[model samples]
Target: MSTSIRVIEAVKSVNVQGSPAHWANEQGTRFKNPWTSWREHDWRDMYYILFKHNRLTPKAPENMSTLLPTRKPTWNHEGDDAQKLKATWIGHASFFVELPARANTEGRVPKRGARILFDPIFSTHCAPIKLAGTARITPPACALEELPEVDAVVISHNHYDHLDRPTLTKLAALPRKPHFFAPLGNLAQLMSVGVPQDNCHVLDWWQSRRVEVDIPSQDGSDKTVPAVFDLTCTPNQHGEGRTPMDRMGYPKSLWASWVAREVLPDLSSTSPKTVYFAGDTGYRAVLDEQNEDEGPVCEAFKQIGEKFGPIDLALLPIGAYAPRRFMSTVHCSPKDSALVFKDIKAKRAIAMHWGAFILTTEPIMEPPKKLKEACEEVGIEEGAFICTDIGQTMLYD
Candidate 1:
């Protein structure tokens, strides 16, 4: 089938309706955050957070420059023979993940397992204009040129920090041209940067698309089997805007968390390895007035856990949540991130979206510390919630 036909079929398989325009219609919007009501931050609140909040300024460590370059860990493209799951934190919200391909017995140089990249931002600054905006306090864990060939690239939103233009341009130029999956209405942005239309796939909340990959057998057998990777765009409590002037177009595009699973044809009956990537979120209405867990956001997570748990791993944001009064609607504090970790019932989770940029007033190192405290109070094990160094790659079984 043609690429356009395949996309249409994919949308139909998800049972989504309405035009792309209708997806963002305020009058009949389908997206809703049931737990917390969204209130826009006015100029006064912005001013207060920007100027009045003395604590918001990031205090770089005395040894920051010396320590930034020392965190590098050797990247292992090949995963452990037993677990077959490897993930490298490429700093901030970006990750390079490899899921084991089908066990190959005939050995055709077992094709490198499925390589997936999430929210890749390799530029010095995460903004529309390269010369201005939030500069990276720490360098990228891995350079874009050093990245292994990718099979797929997943973008959560149009925010400059998450969906950077320079990064996309580089990816578009790659010889392999990995498939790009983004939320509804983001295809325009991708195409604007020269990504081919056929290479982009758009998804609405709760919608799923399946991609097929081939891997050589492990035993030197020439035989191969197709591994199916399913990508689903799930709900998140956040807004989308690449710039302040584009606030009106927020709903026109969608923001989301994602869930990915690897299913081998031979092992179809068995459980698959599942990973949850929480692009960005806030935990406002998750708990109600009575402190009961009845909000839509909470319910959505419960539903996610019910349908996709127990998740093997989750990459959750744990920073940029200072001045709660102003950021409560858009960002999740470390405590909030811990709550989400529990809400989704993940087997393991790694903290992300912090340490590389001073997007808010909180100290750069505060997130991991707060996350550990919250996890302890809630009875989560110590190593269960991990904070890896910028260039560290952890093997997850």
Candidate 2:
């Protein structure tokens, strides 16, 4: 039986042990949460919720897309500016980021900065089936076809919501397939969708890899340099599995958050830029209704801050946490996300994981409003953490 919140498993804090550290500790085939101190409900408890508890369906506003309109992004793919960074929301946890151009290679090639897609699911539904499932409540900011050539696609986990096969299939067929990265045991998931094994990279926690993509030339010429960057698989508090049977059976796969840092040739003080994607994570179990912070909180965020303090930009989840008892294990509430904003020492943050779908009982508009209150409560600076429209693009200098 899993340890109850009343009892302490006393999960010890872990430091970065550069990889070769396999996390398949659960009988050498299954993975477990390293940061979560306790899970309030187990399978049996959830069985009760499924059959006995009332599942409140949320009501979305009639003008959801109108209120949070998607704007077609006008991207500068020239890759000329070495100091410009751009981020565009593609709904949910999906985002497109352009790291500054590879240093000192401005005129030699059409080096459109290292472009990355984070947890991109451009399909109309985020599920295993096409006809039914959590249909996209808001249209993608732009079609997947409209995206610029990408260098890497960073995945948080294998959850259907995060790793849509249809999207992956289309991406793999691109003229220049983007390198795909995810946590351990997920290589097969990518492969199932026809991504060549050579194009896939799955890592254990703290494992890092440097990926480079050849930039297109200005005159469509042959001579072009590559944009380089390092992507690190980081730990977080979350569970995995797509179907009910898979959830019941544990010898399952791994889940994670990710860190991406540019590798510029010029080793100047401002050469490297770092971006953190929380993907999906919970700060605490929220066991204490009177005081959520007093519960056993995940410590991984603090470690990430120590390793990569002052992140340039962080895309964090800020919704789908209505009934805290169950959702708090894998999803973060708006208040919980506010704590994450500080824990990672983010320079700036854009809220995600909401507005794209109505997955929980919380009113559709509550996440952003509550996030504002939480930020103010925690003394977070004004504008430090803000919510953007589903397809809005924000540029960083």
TM-score of each: 0.85, 0.89
- Clashing pairs in model 2, backbone N/Cα/C closer than 3 A: none
In the range 1-397, model 2's lDDT, one tens digit per residue, is 1100111112222347543233546354677665544464677556846874445756567898787788888667444344577888888899999887654445454446778899989888877676432787789888889887777888998787788888889999987777888888888889998888888888777778777666555555566666667788888888778888866645377888998887676644664788999988877775425477666788888888888878888899999886777778789998888888788888889999998877777788888999999999998898989998766778776
Task: Report the error of model 1 at residue 4, Å.
Answer: 18
Which runs in model 2 stand beyond 4 Å of their true positions? 1-28, 43-48, 52-54, 77-82, 105-110, 130-133, 217-222, 249-251, 266-269, 288-290
Model 1 bad stretches (over 4 Å): 1-37, 42-44, 49-55, 65-70, 77-79, 104-109, 130-133, 216-224, 266-270, 285-298
lDDT of 2 at 257: 91
Root-mean-square deviation of Cα positions for candidate 1 versus the true structure, in angstroms = 4.6
lDDT per residue for candidate 1 within 180-277, as digits (tens), equals 99988788899988889888988877788887665555555655545567888887777777666766533667788899887555634546789999
The lDDT values for all models are 0.73, 0.77
Deviation (Å) of 84 in candidate 1: 1.9
lDDT of 2 at 26: 39
